[model samples]
Target: MNRSSFRSVLYLAAILPFFFSDCKKSSSGPASGSGGNGYYTRFKMNGSSVEYDSQPFAGITLLKSDSLYTCVMVAYKDVNAGLKNAVTIIIYSANPIAANVGYNDPLKSRRSNGIMVPQTTIFWYDSTGTGYLTAGEFADNTGNTGIAGVIANAKLTITEMTSASVKGTFSGTVYRSDLARSAAITDGEFYLKRSQ
Candidate 1:
């Protein structure tokens, strides 16, 4: 074969895999049946209702990261047609104990004995318009541009947990890391099907 033809063949070989691979739809979150009547996670943020109730698109995952267990849930809430909004919650546990009802943990500023309460991070992403509300931003709700909040007075509860599903509630108060402002979160609950 001519050198030009050989080079063209090599280029196509390299590019074809990527083209085909891209056809697969990437999973948006944990493994749960889409549109199942069993999954829901909702809360009030800044006096507005934030919910991730769609099935198949919302799910939960529990995996160990180093010595700590990582529990994560992602909910896809439709804010518009053809566009999506998402809320992500990640919690770091010192142990694998099921977070069942009335299960509560205090969130402190420093870690102690492998336990870091308030070691959780929550993210709110509006893929269609407004920016995201990160764990740090939630901790810095005082309207001060120069200072961050110190996370404290936080409590998280897992109302139910199993290998196949998980349910929980959480609330807390966070002060800016700079001590500039603070935000309050209350009455939060989530029930998700475990895919992993």
Candidate 2:
């Protein structure tokens, strides 16, 4: 597999187990507008609103390795039938993240504490079985060109972080595997608990 494909597989491998665990939905009512009711993940993709209610399976996770800290946040929903949609964001930093901060340039790596931290990445898996990546890279398929994809702009900010939950917002443009199409995600907001 190509590097991008391999990375995609690795990411899926890391998170699938958490998703499969038993989960329960929150008892709160549905969300309204951008903020209300209870914890929620909502965004507009291509001007279409998509929201995922609070569930134990969708939340944030923190991992540590030597000096690198990785924070992963996931928002997932089973829209209908067997169709599933999900959005995941992965952030890498040199130190433990404990406050409000913005990851503006997800395509640019930064050096910290003598270590090279990788750029943040976002992934979208639509209910239609299509995938989009902010990095603009994917496995080879029919009519696919082996070129790095372009990301016009992407930003994810951690607006609030507490021992109980993490609140954030994100906006970005992501490209399909073959670069044939792009999706704009806006007005993204998520309030998720820390995954145990």
User: All models: lDDT?
Assistant: 0.46, 0.58
* lDDT at 186, model 1: 67
Residue-level lDDT tens digits of model 1 in 22-116: 11233564333334576776777656676766541223323434455555565556412212454555565555535652322333223345433
Residues 43-143, model 2: lDDT tens digits:
99999998865351233334433345666776566422122476666666655665567665523333444433333566677777566756422322121
Which number leads on lDDT?
2
Task: For candidate 2, list the clashing residue pairs, or say none.
Answer: none
Q: Which 10 successive residues of model 2 have the least lDDT summed?
A: 136-145
